[model samples]
Target: MSLFDDYHPLKGKMFQILKPDGTLHPNMKPLLSDQEIFNLYQKMVFIRLADQKALMLQRQGRMGTYAPIWGQEACQVGSGSVLQKGDWVFPAFRELGASLMMGVPLKTVYLYWMGNEEGSRAPNGINMMPVSIPVGTHPLHAVGTAWAAKLKGDKIVTISYFGDGATSKGDFHEAMNLAGVFKVPTIFFCQNNQFAISVPRKIQTASETIAQKAVAYGVDGIQVDGNDLFAVYAVTKEAVAKARSGGGATLIEGVTYRFGPHTTADDPTKYRREEDIEPWKALDPMVRLRFFLKGRGLWSDEVEKQVTEEAQQEIDQVVKEAEAVPTPSVEDIFKYVYAEMTPQLKEQMEYLKGTL
Candidate 1:
């Protein structure tokens, strides 16, 4: 039998309640009430503003390098806001906004970009890892964490966030196999933003869709409109609950776009076309949320001004805090390598201190 044939049929129902034009589908109307919708809109706006501020800081040489989350606000805020405090999150390099939603301090995130090691340290109760830059490797950690949680009989789930390119990696497949065999409480979320750096999605994989890959490991998978905040929130909510309840794993493919260059150092114009991006801008996550809010008389120019100013002030404060942190010492390099430093590492540390 075909892999998909054995998996649950999607039946064209991916649980999206909001549309790009700000209209709600009947199926989604009952899932979230008006107040909840307004709250979602507020969170999306806050993340978008913070993201833009981060880019500005990078350009001004205040940040080492910044990854813009401009277009993927819905995907981050939607999935992130749903996470409970005790749940573990394994994030790739691109999940800054999501991290913030999971109670990662905005200043720590900024400090990370400013080359501070403390930025990687999660708070006491947060089960989040330092951002993973190595493509597709963190999912294995997510699987292992989930296995631990399951063995301890904890009602916790480990959600690992990665991009479409990650799915092509051997680590990703191995992680999936392990999760399936052990019934690990893990959720694999793939933000398919259509490009893995300069390579298009088509060039990244031969599969019909990234979601279909879930079938190989006996898991449920779904594709959602990443730009639609409601869709992302609802689908991820279900996935998280299922994992915590011992329903095994899920692979959610959030189809979104990167509206900016991969990083401040790269030029996207060399790879993607302007014509392709123009239309997608109209379907911007923030704009759609604004439209929805206005329809319900929850949006106003006064509120916009107030929110923008508040976000700016908060970002500015975080930037200052990040800048105030001291640089790492020579001992720092050797100290965290293990519980106890090896003689070779101790000698190297002494040599570095003398060279300085």
Candidate 2:
């Protein structure tokens, strides 16, 4: 049987392959070579460093407001590793790591946070969409992409990365239903980080788990240990394979946590308790992966030091690249909104110019 069927959300089984201490069940082990695992683990370290650098840049007035993916690296990296060249990713604002995994240049990600519209443009042959800022609207966009691919007889799968808070929005449900009805190649990936800005998950929904919501849409749902890299990769691999083979969409609840605030503009301390964060820290995805690699004699303190140093150097270069970009003109904003600027947009642009 498939992993999705074996650990359905209704069955109260949160799919887990690796324990927090770096042990894994042989039966559930994913097919990854030691070198590949090491490379992926290095990527996770680089992601964390890059995320921390973004936070620092925002604090120091070097960049604009940014969302820090402090505790959710594995969710992105694990699933991202399973993606093929033709697959597409529609991400919410907080997918810097996943974007990197999907072949988006770190320079491009930095440029986007640096407020350049040019940053939204993905590289040639990379089917990634522009990052969606609206809370929960892009899942529908993923479904639409999947539906189009289905119609064209394309074998690619489309996945949407969102948060638990998004599930409360109508757009998420609409996307889920449409994907289900059409039997499109879509993966609804929800990173349930336990908070919707200041509001907690309990107030967001009455459902026991977000994965169970898939039942209403006639799709498979599986709650997963999002921090367990092996489990996330295994489950996503299965879902992507199923979708590519003409199976319908699946809703994957990556049960993870956010160590940082929702975004740089918000203060998490005002709403969350310090004690509540302690337990989640133990499940630090990178640390466990490091442990696993070390156990296999692939990683050591020296290797970590070298990897971190290389990542920081790359981040420094990217930050410089983003900063070197020429500032956009005032007219550039209104010009890029549509193919031909609407009368209303033109008027608004004129008004803004007059005020300036």
Candidate 3:
């Protein structure tokens, strides 16, 4: 069957459970048990708090430019929860929560924002790559990894995270094309936050939706409610399973909103209207999940306080630890790029050493 075959009746519509009004959609049954749902909620809350703290750290000049993952907690946690220890995650710059879910240390995430190269290295056996900041380039790395896994008969899936803006890049097409041709077990997750820096998504591409582009590449294309944690989790879980079962690749376009500035260096007030953000706040993913949990009798006021406190304490500790890491030495920059330094690189390294 073609990846975009007629088997998936819910292709364009996708599957979503929790709604904006904090109620679960009747048609969408909970694939996870109540305990799992509650756990997801707690994880989302923790990740959100960590993201906020990172932003504050950036503003305080303790870290380099940071990307706030506010309003997209569900998108990260839901999708990230699907991976096993063996599956690999290739992340773009904004996926801190996803990285944490995939076994990256929270301190390392903070250390990354603090400009330490060591922070980029995932723990041994974590199967994650350093954050790729140059747009859609990392998808190719994901494809390569998936191809290698396929060759070894490992059945390990590789998921690449990028933004909607990345969909417009040549690398996105190349990676998608190669994955489709090779039938690699890969997932191209495009977080359609509707903006590429200052450019609104309307101008990003003429394509109606990023998922639709998958049809051309012979991949199962899907569009999910990015803010709905349950929906994101369900779709990603299915995609990962499909990949593992040799169903080839899938492209998931998560339609979500960005509530804050793109980064510390960005000023959204200059380009976007204030009203553009107001409606999305009403659709806040965290609030929806919290409401759902409350309806299920899994959340209480006391629990809220306890969880918030826990999240805050963890964030505080990560901040302190990340800040404590020593700054990279002048020579450290010249060390990692190549195994055997070229003559020009050696000369430049000597010059940097003399300057230091």
lDDT by residue (202-296, candidate 1, tens digit) is 99998878887888888888887888888888788888888888888888888889998888888999999999899888878888888888888
TM-score of each: 0.92, 0.97, 0.95
Task: Indicate the TM-score of model 3.
Answer: 0.95
- The list of candidate 2 runs beyond 4 A from truth reads none
| lDDT, model 3 | 0.87
- Candidate 3 stretches greater than 4 Å from native: 1-14, 353-356
lDDT score of model 2?
A: 0.91
Cα lDDT of model 3 by residue, 105-184, tens digit: 89988888888888899999998899888999999999999999999999799999999999999999999999889999
* Candidate structures ordered by TM-score, highest first: 2, 3, 1
Report, for every candidate in turn, its global Cα lDDT versus the true structure. 0.84, 0.91, 0.87
Best by TM-score: 2
Better of 2 and 3 by lDDT: 2
Best-to-worst lDDT order: 2, 3, 1
